[model samples]
Target: MRSLITHLAALTPEQLSDLIAARPEALLPPEPATMAELAERLNAAPLIDVALLGLSRPELQIAEALAALGDGCDRAELAAALGVASDDADLDAALVRLGEVAVAWPDGDRLRTVPLGHVWPCPLGLGAPLSALLTEQRADDLRRIARRLGVPAGTQKAVTVRNLSAWLADGANVRKVSTTAPADTQELLHQLAWEGPYLDEPTYRYGRRTGPAQWAVEHGLIHVAAHWGAPLQMPCEVALALRGPDYRLPFDPAPPSAPTRPVDGESVERESASAAATALAGMVNLLEECGRTPVAPLKTGGVGVRELRRLAKTIGDSADHIRLWLELAMATGLLAPTEAGLLPTEEYDTWCDQQPAEQLTELLAGWLSSEGAPLHQPAGTGQPVPALVHTADGAAMPLLRAAVLRVTAGLPPGAAAADAQAVTTLARWRNPMLLDHLDDANGLVEGVWREAQLVGAVAHGAVTDLGRALATDQPEQLATVLDRLLPPAEETVLLQADLTAVVVGTPSRTLTVLLDAAADRETRGGASTWRFTPSSIRRALDAGSSETELLTALRDRAAGARVPQPLEYLISDTARRHGAILVRPVACCLRSDDPVLLKEILHARSLSTLGLALLAPTVVASTAPIAETLTALRNAGYAPVGEHPDGTVAVERPTRQRAVPLPRASDVVTAPLPLPGPYDPGALDELLAELFEDADESHPLSGYLIPTQPGPLATSEPADLARRLLRAAARRTSRR
Candidate 1:
């Protein structure tokens, strides 16, 4: 961080101005204005939280592991404990995540979780205490030993014991662990490790009944620790010696990569986007139908088997295609779920109104704005791979998608490759295992077409105008490239003698409502066909359209083609029967023009509840009124007036209301995986200091840990030191 600050400080003012002006997100609070400001932000807790939430699960797990240990641990030991080979992708990924977040860093080939409790407040597991791993017995024995040595209690006692332990630890082996040795020896090591690395006694047995305590004392392997609240001490150097020569516990090698896939063009021609286009077209048509006659939602909130098959037949598509498109519509905000059923949301209408290019952008962008591919699954898999459901393969898909786009962007003009090539290329770069499951090969390939080629992001397997725009992150370029695919909105249709009208393409909202009102859509596609009928005409009148108004709208929208005679006749005929009788709601009134009918009604027992009143010989009225009165009168075997004011019977139409679409979700981008950068000397020094202090406080017995001592462990004569050096030189010259 300091080095970064220094580098930024040295940059020219003009360069800094350009940087701040170009990227607004960089200037946010905790934003660095200079090297000093950057350093301050690096230390801020809020910034750390921001980094933490972005971590992958393994990275977070590894971090918490370090937090629990509260110190540096060897790489090999971690690999052994995790049961992951050293070169395993997961371990690599975890290490990468830790480095990116700056939560852990390398210390002499070991990893040290830095800033301790601040970095991970809730650690995965707490490390065992030091005394449990070292001591053989209780503190009472250490007190007796102190008395025998005339070590008085207090600061003086602490110093005297510290000196003794330091002397005794000088040339001892503290971490000598043997797993394949005798059962008793292994048992002894297990007992000590399970107990935590601590010592509270002076005397000990090296094993269950070895009785090597005093012998070990004479050999300088164990001594009293008057400081650090423990009774025994094992020096740092000896602990390192106890670990195998290389120190780290080792891991097995990673499995070899599978043989390269053959470049078979057999599936090449099958990659045309007709299926995708049909799927999209069907998606729109199905949503519109669902809005018209919604089916019951499944108990699990998905389309039930009955509804699925019904929808599939309605759109003339397979069940899988229908399901895929239905889900895609919902995911892309083009449709939403309502109590009635799945329906085209308000966003659908707005989306329809958009130019084709813009709509394609929304479609493709929506494709990118998710975590998992619901439609992309391996063969024989029952569970759907929806967003937020993390799996090894599913998790890597986003990065894979991003990487391929980048690869395409880097390609030269007019240079292109098929899905097979792209998939093969990406697999080699990240994790080849991703392509091992062959269940979703078609889906994997289709994505390239529907998500990329169709959006103008890639053309002929090469990144083109819009692709360049997205790759370069230029909004205006994207718009410019997509303009070619956007369909212009129209408000007219062509009428035929068979009472059918064809809208060549999508029409404006007003025309769509009119068509929906007065005609039944027979076929939907690039060009949709609608048929006019008497019932459909009545539907128009029910939606507040008068007979005359309906005729005018039809003629105006008919592309100047005369309204079909059948359509006109159908409209007039429906209008003629539109209204014929009138009934006004009233509390109570009665008059009769026919004395016989009046007498019949007056003699009826059912009329007793109404308390029927007679105001004239020609009319009769009752307290029960309007709709309810009509039903009661009919049930009583009497016919009554319940027509509109125009003396015409009313035809009912379903009140269609568009549901509010869910808020437009932000487009998701797989943020680039962060790589470890060069660490500044100042930060390294601070971290090292903390690690050393932790080691000094407790003699770490972990095979993974290396403890620290403050001063020289022991003193020796010059002649002795010379002789030790000569023997070491002799050992070095000999064969292992």
Candidate 2:
């Protein structure tokens, strides 16, 4: 296929046209149509042909077909013969030929076309030849035409051969030319050229408005018009005229070059000096206005060179004028140079203050009115006071006046004006005189007055005494005066009350006894220890005895008893020390209901170690059961006996008895007790003898005993019964 296309592309335009006209029907080798067998054909102008055919077709085919037909062959004639519209085409071959005709037309300002009369074989079969050729031209031109006709630009550009034939056959002008003038018409047009075959009104305007003449006004175009008119109406025009069409109106030019060298030294110095003097004059004037003094020298009745230089710098003036001003001020006795800076004396200050306000205004007005004066008010406004003034000699008038005031005012008390002037003229001032001197002048007398007032000097004046006495009385006045005179220290003192007791001496190690009557026997070592109950002390006193006596008795009672070492020491210490001390109250009483037990406890000289345990039952039984102790004892193989609901107990019994016999010095005895013999007269006699013996011994039970025994033999013969009982008891007791 590529080879076939390449071969076809290599063909002459005529051959290609013939091949296209043939229109092969199959991809394989095919037969060609006979030339005599003509197919229905379409014919039109080249413009319409090209619009329909597109640019990629063979141009020669189009031209050859048109040539084959006789002259004056047009789309209209061809469409008529084919029974279609004048602009329509019957065959694609005819459309391609028309495009070739349009391409051959000449290029010019107007849309060029060949007269249809130039073609052969009228396609419409008309006897007369077609008048003209119709063309669509470029797509853009077609669009413009459509837009002018109010048709939307989106309308397709392709025109049927019939349409072109009809449009051209009407004989209307088929071209457009813009008559608008160029923007630079006033300036010579150096160049000319055709711009477009298709144009719009906005595009024409854009071209005409080029150049600086249309530059925007906001870009710094100055208005030179005196009155608002055309020049003002179009300021941009003026700008453009000055800057030219291509010139950038808004561009700023480069800055002016500076001088290569400064002015001659002498001229520069003169200028500087002049400026300095002018500034100094201004300062002097300002000071006077502000009621300040100016500095001056004492020697020459003027400001010294150094002082003048200093003042000039301060007031932005030259040393020369400053010196002159200072000299005049000193001569006039208005300014004085002291240890402080140059200052106006009191007289000068007073004069300055008292000077009429109008005088200042007049001076200011006069200065401002002078020729070439810079201090004048603008035109059309009320006359204003001059901010500065200069004499014919360039001496600042205000400064001279201020300096004179300073010298005069600063004169010492009783000192002549001439003397003050001399002092100021001779003095060299290193500081500003105006403010310093004015302050000093007022401060001198004012300071003294302030001090006087502060010290109550006013109160002590002659009228005060008389007034005070008249207002009140002599006594009141004296008291008031004294109160005022006396210092606060002499008037009052703080009396502080000492409420807390503070011990100042070291404490002694004195023994103190704590008679805890609530302490039970378990807590006490033994009765031998001086363990007194709360009731014991009360009982002692109740029995007509003092605490000291009771304590002594206890001490003596425990003196020889065996007890714990700590317990003995505690008892002795408490008895010796606590007895004499004044205790608020001491009482003792039994906390149990067992009076018998209490009596038994009292009768004993000292309790045994196990005696406390035995007493526990009675104590518990008499009071409460002591549940905690009972539970503990029961768990330890001891049973509670006679326990009551109120936690009281009569006794506690060991749960089990020991199987072993008690140890004795003589022999080992393991046998249990034999049953007692039948009751008899001898048994009673024997028990009585044994009881008597046991009672006579110093033992635990010796104090409590009864001398009685049970027996029936007493009713029989007393001699026989006694004899029998004695024998029987002897026999029973002797058994081993």
Candidate 3:
């Protein structure tokens, strides 16, 4: 100890302060030694400086010295001092030991001692026994005492006692004066005292003046000290202890237990869905109510701003909830949005009023019934049907059914008396038998039944009679029913012209004649300027006449009858360009081997020639006769080409190469052909044979044998011949 003191004396002021503070109790001798004797004993040799202290002591030795010093001071204070430079593990151990000492100390109060040369004060005033401070058995007695003093029961007795002691020490009489515990204890006491006052009430009364504090006091969780002037605050130590290790009061009550059985996962989910549906219904109801006028709901006289506000508040859910109900109502056609507001349309309202109650009930039953309820199951499923399951209202089903009926019903006639009777009869039957009646009356009710089917109101074969009756009574409605039940017409007369065209393709020409007569009669009578009405033209076309034929007939009829100019022009224009050009192959291949003859054939005296020209070499050897003609040809600028042997002459090539210039009669007379052979049948036949045999087989005219005719023929005759040839060829191909 003397060596330790000598070492401590050698430390710097900060080091000395730390050493003294760490273990103030250790600074004094346990058996009271004189200060001078202590100093003399500690002063052995020259002391080492604080900086050199670590050089002489090992780590363990230093730690031991520090720990020895700690024993004399308050454990917490010593631990804190040692922890200043200590590692985490050592610091943790020191802190734990300090905590034990703190808890075990009398009154659980913190100890304070002076540094190195000073005296320590006793922390436990009056040196109260530790057992008295922590007396557990006294809790009940303390609670009773608290109740008698008007403090809360289950109050922290230790804290109460501390407060009472403080008041007493302040010179106030504990029994006569009033006092409060610490802030925390006061709150706890208030809560305990006030809690019981309204325990049985349905609703809690909470306010600044009548809140938790007042409630706790009535329930007894706190106590008040008696000293009046000296309000004894609860000691931090005792109040902290009352809080417990878990930080909850031992007397804090648990929440009340639920009354219903726990819901299964499915049931919980269904309940949530039901809640959402009900909320949606409420929103719809509010919207409908807003739409009603004073005359509409006579009982209310008239709704006001207050009513609207109340309605809004009643359905005060998310905007989506309101929107959903509105959409459902619109889709079902129960309500329509108008300029005024959302209102039931006449069809919807009438349907609501007239719908069969039982049918409506069945429909709504499907919507509101919960899956959990046994009654919701079908009858054969072993569960008894509930006599009465809750619904939106008894009337809701009927209204909804009516709405469905109205939406599905086709356009009504002046009145559908038969349909009304049929519906009434169907509605009279109970559910199990209704389907039978409907099946029996299928012919009468097919249309209505089909309409219902479209909206999923009834199953197939369930309401056939109703559907048929609807169809018979309301044909227009049949369109809607048909649209639902059958495919649309595969072919429709999209345009009047298209229909007319079809009519024109008919085998008989009766329609065409009638249309032509109508036009002639109209023109003769001067009924109108136009030769034919669109209807007449259509009729003609539909009568098996093509558009071109119809227009041509109109024009011919008009001209012969001296029709108006506008009418003629209309008919002519319609007919002239109405059809495509017709072309065909011909049998007569009138090939020209002589250049002079080819030119003459191409360019004829009349404008009706149809034969093509070809070049051939002449057998004549003299150049003079041919050159004179050539000069005349070159002056005329006739185009020419090299020719083959066959008594054919090749014309001189012209400056501008073009299709061979067909000869005019003037050219034929001015440039006479130098005939190489006599004008004989055999020669002509031989020429024709050679030309036909030498022609390319692929040419359309190659198969034909040319006639040895001497001159030009009629244009129509040749064209007719071509058409005949084409027909014959087609027939032959078909046979092959």
Candidate 4:
């Protein structure tokens, strides 16, 4: 087979430019002046890795087997190596794709690739060739194999090795020698041939006694390879012959199709919308919690498992469920990291103002491209991968996620496959390079499924309409679908005598805020339940709600039913005792307009921390600082406000802090495989135009663009430009 450079040299200037345009400029040779340099750069390790990303499963399989076969192999030989038919259309297509990517080219009837021996050691788990292993074998063993093969056993070690290598090269000769082995030994040889062409010593107990391994070794069928990952290795030629006419292995050229069951489309929509609403509620709850008190991250820079569990308990949800919401919060910029911990960002307020459908649409967009893998755990480790830790830098999680969504989108509406493995298999087939880490693929696939379900992109294991919109990046379509599927919001609640209230559907923003102020949410889902408690009523009072206003609001939102007596009584009673005991910040001295109010504070035991001492009938003095006094009063259920030196109210605004936004989805390149330059179609043409321009003769770009050396044409003469143009034109005409 001819070298890749020789094949490249035959292409016209336009064809070569098109090929160069297919790759990024960064992957090409720097200032290449000849076809040889271009070939070298294209076949370089990094570029080859990138080119392989465009191949399908069968294409990649053929490439791997061809590289393993060494030198070059005919179509039949290549098919035999992969245990497939030579005339298979998939095989033919795979060869064409290899040529298109410049990973391999056709030479007569054989296919040749770049020298990949260094790139993939032992491709397809096949061992080193018999010729390469000859150097490591014992001299006596070599001579004995030569004598058994009816080849002259030369006295010198090198001569005997040379003679055996020639014999092993011929498939007919290798099969003839295999006839001496017993039937059991032949069976073992065939098994080794298809299954990695090697056997572990411990599994076979080869050197112990008269076994099949021993019989094969004595007949020159298998040999010891101590430096390999396995102990014993069968010669490449012998393995191919043992496979026989219809060489077959476990390789699957086509992707596995998952078995699916049908479901009702309406039911799927209902469930998915419900899940999406639940997910939205969970995120809102998380933001409110973070705003109230910034959560401290672990020493390792992520939320600890214990803290997440505690939050789960507080929110009445499982830890795993909460983890998904937390990740969504991070992904959408609702929450950001701070020096203190993780806090709700300013974006959270705006996000909360949007409708449920709009809110969910934004979340789905972020999730589709999010690098967060909350449900993915390291192998053998009980801990899950954490979010907001920036640990996913350079990882292909976003690419894998899109691939999984693509597979799900292919299923018929309201149809669900049996399990995630089918989706994983299909996804792996489409983007072979993205899921190259075989050990981590399963965990990532499972995590994508869990996240998609939690985000309402999937329901009953089938993709929803909103999910299809998300996958296609149609935001308007996503919003329309969600609005149609999501249940309408209710403006009222069912009040019970037991001081509990229930909303039959999602509550309107106005009613939701009202309930949050006066009641504690006990549970939330499709429907939400709230309990009216003394503490909850007190919270409403503390937030500046008057007793009359609270009562009127409750009455207006009671679903045309009268407010329960027990709930009304609880609220009235709590308001009555709310400010019976008032404490004020005693800045050196405490003064009040009423002498009786001062008297009440002086006698209260809880006010002892204020260190109050009477100075006059309307005044008291304290040794504690003003700030400390104010906190103590507030903690003791007292209404306290600081005063200025002029006796006016002191109003201070709290500082709003924000962290740097997380890496956006757009920032992550979709091609997870190592690709050269961000390809631009015009770069190659621009480069070529500059090469023959009547500009600076010593331009560096000319060296980068021209595949042929610019010898005498280096001058900026008119004839030089015309001549080069004519030459390029001739090359194009010849190709046509």
Q: Would you estimate the TM-scores of all the predictions? A: 0.49, 0.13, 0.14, 0.62
Question: 297-361 in candidate 4: lDDT tens per residue?
Answer: 88877788877877777777778877778777887888888887888887877777677777887
Candidate 3 lDDT, tens digit per residue, 476-500? 4534443333222112111122112
Lowest lDDT block of 10, candidate 1:
674-683
lDDT of each: 0.50, 0.28, 0.30, 0.68
Off by over 4 Å in 2: 1-247, 256-262, 265-270, 289-736
Model 1 stretches with alpha carbons more than 4 Å out:
12-28, 37-280, 294-297, 304-306, 318-324, 331-334, 337-349, 352-355, 382-400, 408-416, 427-468, 542-544, 564-570, 573-651, 658-736
Best-fitting candidate, scored by TM-score: 4
Which residue segments of model 3 deviate by more than 4 Å?
Answer: 1-230, 238-248, 251-256, 294-736
Cα RMSD, each candidate: 16.6, 61.4, 46.0, 11.0
Q: What are the per-residue Cα lDDT tens digits for candidate 1 across 177-231?
A: 2333356544433343333233445443452113433433323334444343344
> Order of candidates by TM-score, top first?
4, 1, 3, 2
lDDT per residue (tens digit) for residues 84-115 in model 2: 45443333444544333232221221112233
Residue 223 in model 2: lDDT = 15
What CA RMSD would candidate 4 show? 11.0
Task: Find the candidate with the highest lDDT and give its number.
Answer: 4
lDDT score of model 3? 0.30
User: 2 or 4: which has the higher lDDT?
Assistant: 4
